[model samples]
Structure formats: C-alpha cells, structure tokens
Target: MNALVDVSFFPRAAKPLASYRKFWAARFGTAPFLPMSREEMNQLGWDSCDVVLVTGDAYVDHPSFGMAVIGRMLEAQGFRVGIIAQPDWQSAEPFKALGKPNLFWGVTAGNMDSMINRYTADRKIRTDDAYTPGDIGGKRPDRAALVYSQRCREAFKDVPIILGGIEGSLRRIAHYDYWSDKVRRSIVVDAKCDLLLYGNAERAIVEIAHRLSRREPIEHITDVRGTAFVRRSDDDTRLGWFEIDSTDVDAPGTVESHINPYQTTSEQAAGQGTTCSKEDQTVRPEPVEGQAEASTSSARTDAGSGSKPLRFMPNPALPQRVGKQVLPPRERTVIRLPSYEQVKS
Candidate 1:
C-alpha cells in the first residue's frame, strides 16, 4: 500500500528538471547552452534588470581586457550585464535580447577609427566579398556611431544612453578623419546619448554605478571622475563649449581646460609614469622629464606664452592612447597641467 502512494515535491523545494538537463549536457559532449542556472543568475544580484554592454571589439576574458573588466565591474556592483559582441549595429536582435538596459555601455576597438574605415572601405569596394554573409551594401560614413545610437533609440526609450570607446572618443571633437575623409563633432551630440564617458572609463563606470544605485538623480550628479560631458560654456552660447571636471570644482570651460597633460599626480604614475587620481577621475597627461623631452621643446614653455604647449592626442598604437595624449607645447595648454602634489595625492 505504501508503494502505491505518489511522491510529491513543492515547486520551490524541487530542483527544476531544466537544471538537471543542463547538468547532463555539461557532463556530456554538448557545450551547456546556458552557462549559469536560474538560481545562479539570481545570485549574481542584478537589480531585477540588466545593463546591456555593447562592444565594438571581440569578447574575451583577460585582466587587462577592457570589456571583461567593465563587465566584471558591473556585475560586482550588483548590475546584470549582457554582452553583445561585434554587433552589426544594423541589426535589431542585439538590443532586443536583454529587452532594455538600465544603463547602455559601449566600447570600441583600440583601432576604432582605422577599423571603421577599413570596414566601410571594404564594404564599398567589395562585390563578391562573402565575409559579411547576409549584410546589405549601404554603409554610412559614420556607420558605427549611427548604428549604435539608432538601436538604442529604437529599443530603449527614456533610458540613459552612455557612449564610450574609440569610435566615440576620437570622434568627440570636430576633427578630420583620413579614412572617412570628413570632419565631425562630439559623438555624444551626434549619437544623442544622455552622457559620454570618454577616455579609460573603468573607474568612472564604477562611480556611476554607485551613484545610480544610491538613487541620486543623474542630472544633479555632477563632477563624475574619469569622464567628460558636454554643456554650454559660461560665456559662449553655441561654439563656446568644453569639458569641465564633473566634481566639486564647478568652473565651466573648454575641453582643453579640463585636460590633465601630466595624466595624474598619484603614485601610480611613478614607475610606469602613468597617472590616475581619485581626486578627479579625469586622467592627466604624462610629464616629460630628462631624456624624455629630447627634441620636444614645448614642455618647458608657460601657457601664457604665444607659442602653443604640448598636448597628447590619441595614438592607436599605445594601450594608454585611450588614457592620455602627447601634445605639442602649444597644444599642451589645451589640457590642464597637473602639479607634483596632484600626482602623488
């Protein structure tokens, strides 16, 4: 009679059969489709929503890896993150997967400008190129930037859009590009994102998550570290615009005004001569001392002099290019100069 009785388990008490099937797949030859279980996803502690991180580069898990670092950082901060790798930007599926992100994260290749040029040039000239597979031919001049913006606008309305990475940074100003053969201004304006965190955005991203977690209104939260935002200049209405320290240092000025030519004034810059400061998340330019200044006279000149000081711009070659620039003496003043104390502090 006891054998005739049916065994019953509560919904919450029993492990779902799906979990067992996934485990079986893991044990067998098949790669488990979902790497983590539902319980694991819940344990990751996402705030009931996800942060969609769209990247321009291929995805991998390495310490110095930009997307990996940011993704790990976001998860550590209690946000759910879904990565869309090398998105076509032309397709809607990438953005459609996660529904909508609480925050939109972007990253570009170290050679974003060159990469886009190559991608576009390839598309324009190639007739039998089977690499794109099903991709249609009409590529735009600003293909990467436009596709990112359009998808975000279509999929996630009202959510704050943040733009970073190479595609956005080098294009942050009205400058000429060799590949596209055109001049453009800040990507933020063109892409219509609420904010753009240019340069190396790791630390800045963490602070941004912290702020958002606190429920502090995004607009009132000023002086964010390690990032740049566009706003009206103090005097000029239209053309007079630049980057200001998003912290307590409330003065507004041009993009050149906020650049730290020395990069940072902290101990981090001591050995590698790299500087990053928590005081202001913005990175300063590296200091040129001794033999480093060979053939570069602009290093010693005062900003007040008629001649330009050195300024560091992006160099796709260096890992730090995204972090700092090496400017001529005249352009050096375009970004701020960091004091020795600032570097140490």
Candidate 2:
C-alpha cells in the first residue's frame, strides 16, 4: 500500500506597492489619489509578472472601484496587475511602458461617455486640493483616441484589445449621441477591439484569464456570461426590431427604447413613468434671499444655476397613419445588462 498526498497551490494576498503618491505628485503637483508605495509593492510581492490595466479613470479605493478588485483577483491568480490610471490613452507610450498584459480590462463608473465628459469637460468638478490640474484649467486633450490606441498598439499589436469600461459598454450599439461634436455608434466598432465585455465584470474577467492561460482563442471563449463583441454584419437580423401592436405599444414615436439596455424585460417593457412614485414626488422648497419660496411654480423648473441636464430626443420611429408598408424600425443589437432600464418600455 502507498500513501498519497494532495498539494494545492494558492497565491499570496497582494500588499501595497511603491507609493503612487510620489509619482502622481511629481506629475500633477497635487494628490487626488491614495498612496501606493514601493515598500507596499514589495510587501504585496508585486513584480513584472502582472497584467497592466489601461483605463481612463483615477485610481481610488472607493465604491466605484470594481475594476480594482478585478485586477487584484488577477494578481491572486498568479498574474501581476498594474493600473495606468487615466493615461493619455491617445498615445502608445504609457501602455507600452507597463509591458503587455494577458488581458486588457476596461470599466466605466456609470456610463463610459459620461466618465469621459467628467474628465474632459471644460468645466470640471473641483477637488479638495485647490491646485489640481483641472482647477489649474487643465482639460483632457482633444486626442483621446490617439493616446488610447497608441499605448494599446504599442503593448499588444496582435494581442487582444478588450474594451469594457462604461465608455465602451454603453456605446456597444449604434447609438446616436454627440461626441467630439458629432454622433457615433458601436464603441467596439469604432475602437476596433478584439472583444467588448459589459456589465459588472469580476466573474467574467477571471474566466477570461483562465481561458487565456490555456491558450484558447479569444473568439471561442464566449460561453462566459456577458456581452460579446462581434462585427456589425454578424449580428442576428431578428434582433433589430419587434412589431408590437401599435395600440398596445407603450412607447411610441420614441427612439428611447432603441438604446435602452433594459428594453425587453416584462417589468420594463410594460412601461412605467419615472421611478418616483406619486407619493415621493413632493416638491422641495427652494431658498430665495434667506426665505423659502412657496411651491406653486412648475413641478419641473431648472434652477438658474450652471448645472442643467442634457437631454436628447430622437425623431419618431414610426410615422402616423401611413397608408403604405414601410421598413420596420431597426435599432442596434444590444444585450440588456442589470444596470439597464427602459425609459419607455
């Protein structure tokens, strides 16, 4: 008889690495980021054997830090992970500097385009630190794509370029929205990436890494649960539009349903007004010259302040009382994620 023993391998937990504060301070002259130092790196045992996460975001361990956890998980799976926070994604140098990654993980705070707006907007939010770059009137350069593609190409000209963050996900369809003073569609189509992973990504990312480790082709690994990017012509035609009875249709004469990620669900497709129930729609008094004003004004009035909501209303999808049969209204194919909602179901 022979005794057998099983040995299991588990990667060590990562510790803090070299302080990122010193680097950021030298570059921007202020700290809007938490410090991650070399000593911390050594304690965390981070080495060159990690994946570089190229993104358009500031690295902070906050609630919006889902991407950070994904990176850490990759490191635990025996891959090092470094973040190129909000790099000049137009250029290739920053991405090249960090070396090639096994996977390029992307994410957005809430929406990808919105994130770009917050960072690149002429009027940006002020940080507690008075001398931050935007406060000093530093805005994102016009060449955002150039920077992103350059770094991406430099690192992995042939490696898979994954576009995931908010900017990439929401723009995964032929969306009609202004960008660089023009409208655009299908971010993956524009970015020319190998794949576009959408929604909360921790689980999908790990599966991607595992599959890649086994030398599997990126295209064949679509069984993982998440949106998968494909060429425009390859999408199913049936996904374009559904001709519901006009009278029974809830949202008519609206392109809102076309771009809504949650258009198909029963609850959403049933069509409801704003999430605010009638009881929750009470108006709050606005203070004017040290006195609260009576609530007799319009229920929806914009304050004279600088902040105003930006709204877009596309033209009617179906014409009224058409005598002849026309083309069915078609929208870009999109898979509804949990975060999606139907403005008109």
Candidate 3:
C-alpha cells in the first residue's frame, strides 16, 4: 500500500545540471578510476580532490554504479572527484585515505542496501556480495551509510557529509526495519550527516556541489527537492510559508482507510464519511501555531441537501491571478509529515 499527503505549492525553477559554471579545477582530466589512494591522486596530477566519494562497493567504472556515475558527473563539471571504496569500518583510519574533501564527503552504501546485501530473505547472514571484487561479504558494516558517515566526520571534523544510495534513501523517513523488528528514525538523524538525497539525485547533487563551491552553507540549502534533513519544528516561521496537514489527505486514527484515486466516482461517494477497511491510514502530526492554513472554495451543492461541497483551493497567499493566468512567486513551502513519534505508534 502507498501512503500519500497532498501538498500544493510551487517550487522555484530548477537550474539545469550543465548550467552552472564549471569549478576551477576542471583542467585536471578525468581519472580512469576515481582515486582510492594518494598514489592515484598524484598519478592524476591532483593536489586535492574537491569531493571525495566513499562507497561500500568496489570501484567499477560503470554507469550502474552510483559512485561512478556521480564521480564522473562531478568530474565533467570540473570538480576533482575521488573514491574510497569498502574502507575498513573498524576505525577512522581508512576513511582518511583520501585526505579531506575541499567541498564535502559523498557517502553511499553501494548499489544495494547493506542489510539486504549481507542477509537472506530468511534473515540468515550471507557469505557473498556480487558487487565486491571477489564476491565477498562482510566488507561493509550493517547500516553502512551511517557508519561511513560517522567515520567521515571523525576523519575531518568540519567537512560536510552528504549521504545517499539505497540505504540512506530508503531510511530517509521513519521506516520499519524487518531485521531490527522496530521502527528506526530517519537516517539523517542517526547518521548525523549534513544532507540526505533520495531517488534520482543528479539534479539535487549538482546544485548542491555548485552552491557549496560558491561557499553557501549546507544548512541554508534546504529547499532542494528529493532531499530530507533535520531542522527545528519552529524553523518555518521566518519563511512565511503555509503548511498542509498530512491528515487532511490521510485520516488520523488507528485503522485508517487507504484512499485509491483510481476508484470509481460512485465507489468514492459510497465510501465517503465511512472508514475504509482495506488499508491502514497514515497519521499526520498536528499543525504548529503561526503557520497559514490551506485555502478552500465552494464546489457544487448537493441537490437533496442544498449544501455546498467544501473543495480544496489553491493558496491565495501565493501568486495571484492576473486575468485568467495565475503566476506563482518563487517561495519555500513545507509539507509536514508525521512526526517520528506518530509513525512509531
């Protein structure tokens, strides 16, 4: 079953990946393999890599590999990209192999979630990892994203750590862990990383790299889509953005109904005002004070009752209509998701 919440807001126009001016170090040609050691960096004629990528998979120069795709993309944009694959997680020593990144550290748990790669459907520990050079297991620690991020922090106290790949993406929000048999907090909180990029991260990652190169602080770059981060609940006040209660779309309460948009109009009308029994509804957290409420407009009135239907309307606080055209101003808005406490219950 899928859970959803209605969010009505306009995001600013996204800058194209290739639109940003290339970093100053584009003069250094691409490395056949993003360097895993100082020797490789010296061979590539690089004094220091602008971005260092740490992954749990072996270095394969294939597009299928997350590290390769991201590294190559950044290199094309004129940033020195390096790789530290399958570093020993026993201590922070191996993490220091690439020295400190001039921009930030990109950490991923390889192509697969570490837990799934290391375990079986029956929860038995596996003995092989196909992505590894020798098809070996135990190369990456469980929750490799979190472990690697911590190591990066320890290696360079002030460097930013950006977490991605399957592990960080899947666990970006509170999720039930089959192996752990409990709900886990968002990896953004557990890993203590600066940012978490989910799904196809090329767009967000490119923008982030350029912004950081321009010296924009990571904390101030929160409006990017397909990304999640930890911030105080009260942080939205300064932006003057309205909030949408998740429950407005998904009912709050135990045993909530699943809404299927594909259902027939008659089926929807039949289920109206009655709880759905097929799927559980996700609970939304309560709205905080000082946030604007969603707008509403009157739809058709019921013939029998002579009462108008309350329909969701676009936020009037946004760009106003000029004649028949509505133009939205670039602004930052937030869709409030269920709190970690709510999801756990």
Best by lDDT: 3
What is the descending lDDT order? 3, 1, 2
Error (Å) of candidate 2 at residue 194 is: 1.4
Each model's lDDT: 0.48, 0.47, 0.80
Writing each residue's lDDT as its tens digit, candidate 3 over 202-315 gives 888898999999999987877777777777555642365445545554432234568897997556866785445443344656655433232112222235458777765665
Report lDDT (Cα) of residue 265, candidate 2: 49
Model 3, CA-based lDDT: 0.80
TM-score winner, 1 or 3: 3
Worst 10 residues of 2 by lDDT: 1-10
Using all chains and alpha carbons, the TM-scores for the candidates as numbered come to 0.48, 0.48, 0.74
Stretches of candidate 3 off by over 4 Å are 1-10, 234-239, 250-330
Give candidate 1 misplaced runs (Cα > 4 Å): 1-48, 104-111, 114-142, 232-345
With candidate 1 superimposed using the best TM-score fit, by how many Å does residue 35's alpha carbon deviate from the native?
Answer: 8.0
Q: In terms of TM-score, which candidate is strongest?
A: 3
